[model samples]
Target: MRNFNKNALNGKRAIITGGGGLLGPHHAIALVEAGASVTLVDINEKGLKRAKTKILKVNDSAKIATQILDITNLNAVEKFEALQTKHDTNFDILINNAAVNPKMSEIGGQNSGRIEDYNLNQWNNEINVGLTGAFICSRVFGSRMAEKNKGVIINISSDLAVRAPDQRVYSPSESFDDIKSYKPLGYSVVKTALIGMTRYLAEYWGHKNVRVNALLPGGVFNKQPEELVRNVSKRTLLGRWANLNEYEDAIVFLASDSSAYMTGQSLIMDGGRSVV
Candidate 1:
């Protein structure tokens, strides 16, 4: 339950990709509470249901919608835009938050193995979901926003976008010959490229009043192993990972008029992990 400024986003509409993930619904709730209509899009239908239920508990009357969408597919994205039109919902914000993220302990299983042994299929899947997906959504949805000459696109990146993953944090005493748990190359590369996309789109659409920005958030606390938590805490200047709702206000700022003068920038809320 957050005390949001009721008029902050009055009459606005937002679309959040990866809306079924850990942080997406929180962003949706924050915006909805502030008087925006939000449509949650994700590939996971069950996750979408849970996310919608969670948001409804916060704002029972919130104008909410959901679509089982695969953002990686351009055709699917087009179909979603058509559906929104049928519903008379012309969105003003897009949150690119979908990515292939796995826990440190589960890294090896998620294709975070020694580079030489990394599976190309896994690498392609990561890129398609994290990078290509953003491109497709932006091309289809963002172009519409540009035509309207007023909109905001909030790209959800990560602290790893600005700083390389601390591989040491994923340390496990596995044999050199065995599949090691190194951070996947795709995660950092795709996240970093998102910032690049933000800058380019900001300039490309600035004249049309379409502002583009990115959020480079640190790890969120979600009961990871104690060892991993302690390691991350020691590395962060704030001495802890971010609370799940810590970035809510930041997300709202980026999605609303509060950041009217901001564009082509990234809001780094990483507990100072990149500093020291």
Candidate 2:
């Protein structure tokens, strides 16, 4: 049996964007467990509080901080710098996990509509939050990492980054023709762009020892409608949606020294969905 040291990230300082989302808190818990001080940033104040609460529940002694900021704004650069100073961390790791992703329950039922009906404002907003926001965070935070010659960036992408969304998964039946609504094009486009940026930065910063990589995670089970869950589960080789804890180790590995030799890569944890 191989003995893996879970505390491989001792004394590390990490930052996670979109730390208020469904999987964001889980990412924080994983990094905290690995012995890293975490700063969770998000635009949603309530969500940020909830996420921090969850993390505290898991590890009472965990060194955690919460910040509310919009990553796409130019002001984020200053705020990020201030966060590093306030936390007194040189920023050993950055998880670019923020994005405008709507849940299955939010689709059709919420303000979301079909692609043909997707508002121009909505499109630009998603791009700004998902792609441009990532670039802003990377530019401000990653530049410091490059200068220090040490850091890791884990860009959280989706299975759609590689393959187009199976529109059938959103329909009541597995029929594409009868689709009443569809996953917005902006979501897939932004995620794919992140992968490209990941590769570009990996090479751009390789000489500086600032490793960059992307994690393509599949749909996580988050109390969505049963039919939608079943639809996606059948499409996946794993036969079920991913539990929140499933990707913890992968996130930790990418953030820690475990992936020291790896960069410019997309680690797909979609339960073989991309192959099919």
In order, what lDDT does every prediction score?
Answer: 0.87, 0.87
- Report the lDDT tens digits of candidate 2 across residue range 1-276: 112366888999888999998889999999888899998989999999999999999999999999898898968666768667676676889899999887756666435557656888879998999999889888888998998899899999999999989888777877977666678899999999999999999999999999999999998888888888999888889899889888898988898788889999999999888889
Query: For residues 1-276, could you state the per-residue lDDT of candidate 1 as single tens digits?
Result: 355577799999999999999999999988998889999999999999999999999889999999899999999899989877788777899999999886667766546656777788878988899889998988888888998899999989999998988777665433334435777888898899999999999999999999999999999999887867887898999999999888888888898888999999999999999997
TM-score (C-alpha, index-matched) for candidate 1: 0.94
The CA lDDT at 149 in model 2 is: 91
| Model 2 clashing residue pairs (backbone) | none
What overall lDDT, based on C-alpha atoms, would model 1 receive against the true structure? 0.87
